[model samples]
Target chain A: MKRERVTLRFSPDAYDKAITYHLVRDYGLVVNILRAEITPGQQGNLLLDLEGEPADITAALSYLSSEGIKVTPSERQIVIDKDSCVDCGACTAVCFSQALLIRAPEWDLAFDPDRCIACGLCLSACPVRAIHSKFSDPIEEAPPADEA
Target chain B: MATKTIAEINEKIRRGEAVVLTADQAAAMAKEQGVKAVAQQVDVVTTGTFGPMCSSGAFLNFGHSDPPIKMSRVHLNDVPAYAGIAAVDAYLGATELSDGRPEYGGAHVLEELLRGKAVRLRATAYGTDCYPRSQIESDIRLADINEAFLFNPRNAYQNYGAAVNSSSRTLRTYMGTLLPKFGNVNYSTSGCLSPLLNDPYLRTIGIGTKLFLGGAQGYVAWNGTQHNPSRPRNEHGIPVGGAATLSLIGDLKAMSPDFFRAAYFDGYGASLFLGVGIPIPVLDEDLARCVAVTDHDIQTTLFDYGVAERNRPSLGTYSYGELKSGQILLNGKKIRTAPLSSQKKALVIAKQLKGWIEQGDFLLSEAVAPLPQQATLHALNSKDEVK
Candidate 1:
């Protein structure tokens, strides 16, 4: 079976109702309500495992956009930053992806790269703020890994 | 060149020998034996207001303008008194013995099935009636007295891996949608909807080691609007508790197997009719083992029964002895029997079917076998006496 991966950033305000009809309903994916972290006033990331034709993915995006969802191709295939990550543990606490972790000292906070969907969730999750997204390049770099 | 007789099968079963056959072998044997076969059946029987509807989650949503969702009835009044009779008839072309003598050759078939005991039932009233939540619970308790039952929690929930949409463009292929979303995750859908959709239910049946072992989540709900409320003022009152949701995630962090171990290597069993597309003899032994395991890992829950506050499990334990020996359920009631085997049904069936197919006699085929000869003979005898 063919499958595609896509991430849509829900406006931080897209709360309960958005979770119901949009992400979970239209896409057949479940967004971790608990793993979400928004920077006081910033867009939140919704990772979706889209299965079907490329047209279907585009259709879902169009529907979401029309419904007032702010979606963009995610950057930074990896979620966590090795440097400046202090291992302070705020990212892990807010991460529903279970992608980021604070193991300890210099070696603790490692990005699983494989588990990271590049939803840019860690950007807001990080207390020290050291994560970067791929979209900021204003163009395409490479399709992210199929991990998440 | 000689096919085994019922007596020989019985002897092997009596001696506790393994019953084995591949689906091809079972089909060939059944064809040679002249037994009919039917595969993949869904029989939904509802006692009250709710009927089977397709939604990934337990709770269904209704718009005020949308009519009330009523479940249609599914009946199984004619299911053979015993679980594997269809397979037995299909295998040896012989009827089940009312005399209680063990059908030894295929005893394993009767032994390996994972027959459901605790039949969970849940319903919520949307109109004028008092939230006789107690009565709904009472009916469930009564049903529980008759059979093991399940009721969704007090909230409505949707299926996590389901795609619900109004347009054709949204119709993602079921197979395509399965993996990207459900693949690599250990998840259990609410009682395989494939059966309801007239599709094969056990198609996804396999071991945790064979498929992705996703983590398990429980108590998922969906809240949707209700129509025809007795109190017009409370028009916005949405109904919950319409469904139950659970997810199994397959990941290393969970220490679960990434691939569900490939078992039941041969033959196919439909979750709907709980029928297998193989020789009756092979299916019988396979199902018997499945039942034994199912009998073991069982529990039941009912609210008015007040079992929630109690330590009683989800489905009760196996206790077949009290239920008229041959009759598994007494008036639809379980007797807390013990599992005849150690492994689950899928595992046992997988092993037995694989073993059977390796032998030359096994076959895989399909047909709905005729009613047992004894039933025919008894009817003929009664008519003769009357004449």
Candidate 2:
């Protein structure tokens, strides 16, 4: 089994499409919506945690691409500027996922990207403005080259 | 009883024979060998704390321009500074916000200056006869300024309370974010390693005492504003809540960016994270006992920040040991606790101060005047009519 975190962006036209329904029914993938900001007529995005067989997950992503939904890897979504962070542990208070923590003995701040659900809570909790989101807005990727 | 004077300690330091220990090490040694034994062997106990201090600011004397302007209004990097002092002198407060930038403020400007970055300086004057210029604009770096010194009204709080929320909604405060229904507790103190906590009653730390400030030697100028010594104390004579702050001054030109930086809270405004260390000479067995205080002995009240009032409801008092353990039992619930102050940086600073004293590079100073012990705080009365 394979597990991957990804962001699925939907354009206004794709809002009516059943993206998660297709992933679970056709691709046999477990789709967990970590966060979502979808309105009926407006463009929105969903942060999802997908778990399934390697081939099934790949096929589900391909299906999403064909349906005009943009899929972005969640690896680079959250960035912590280590140089500016003082490791005061202020961000750990609001991080429910335990993604941000202060290591014991040394009291150094540690960030585990895998544990983060990208809830965007740590962005404001940081006192030095160190935590930031790279792709906060939905990026509209150019439509796949029309192949007749 | 083993007793020594600050002069004797300084002589030992000069001869490279003074025994110095960081507050944490001294506390452990005291636990092993007892306070009397440690008091006889140790000459100095160094303590440190790195935390956000909102009452910190810097005074800069910019050299006069070609045509001198009596700067009535001054802005540095778009952040307003108090320029009512002289022709080119201004005081930049840490909490002063930029015109539109909420995250950037005077603290950021000071940090950038320490990093050797140039800041834009713009000033306007009413055009005096002696100083004819009406307005001036220029770029100024730390090296270009005549003098830059830090004058903090309050720093190195002796003790502080932990904050928790009892209401249904989360509270965003200077104590960091407190979750609803006491989800988490937030505290800001260096515990046993804090300077004021080690000295407790201001026995060794007072006016004219030379100590480490932002990596530079600074002096305790006065009793800090809101220096309430009348706060209730535990059996060890330590305050149960926030008490006994210090007003400090130092040469900002000689400081390091590592020990000084700007901080912005989620909803709270800008503040400076200052690293301060104070050396407590083992002048007597009494002073030795104070420095030997450990996290297990130090206690503080946990107040509910959910109540939006000056006097919040106190939940209970807990030791720093329990707080540092990552979780504490509050009302039979295991609540996770977090610290706003950096214990790692505080330890590093304490070790650095110990190194300086052991190498005979830094000498202790006897306080010219001791801080008042009977000071009490009073709240402003809005209903009182002005005379």
Maximum-TM-score candidate: 2
Lowest lDDT block of 10, candidate 2 chain B: B378-387
lDDT of candidate 1 over B1-387, digit per residue (tens): 123333454355445453443322333443454322211110011000011111111111111112232212111111112222211111110111212322211111111111212222222333333221221211111111222111121111111121112222311121111112111111111211111111111111211102111111111111122211121111112111112221211121222111111111001111110111112332332222221221112111111111222222222212212211212332354321111111122222333334443342333222223211111101224455656
Choose the strongest candidate by lDDT: 2
Docking class of 2: medium
lDDT of each: 0.26, 0.89
List fnat, each candidate: 0.00, 0.68
Interface RMSD of 1: 23.5
Q: How much does each candidate deviate at the interface, measured as C-alpha RMSD after superposition?
A: 23.5, 1.1
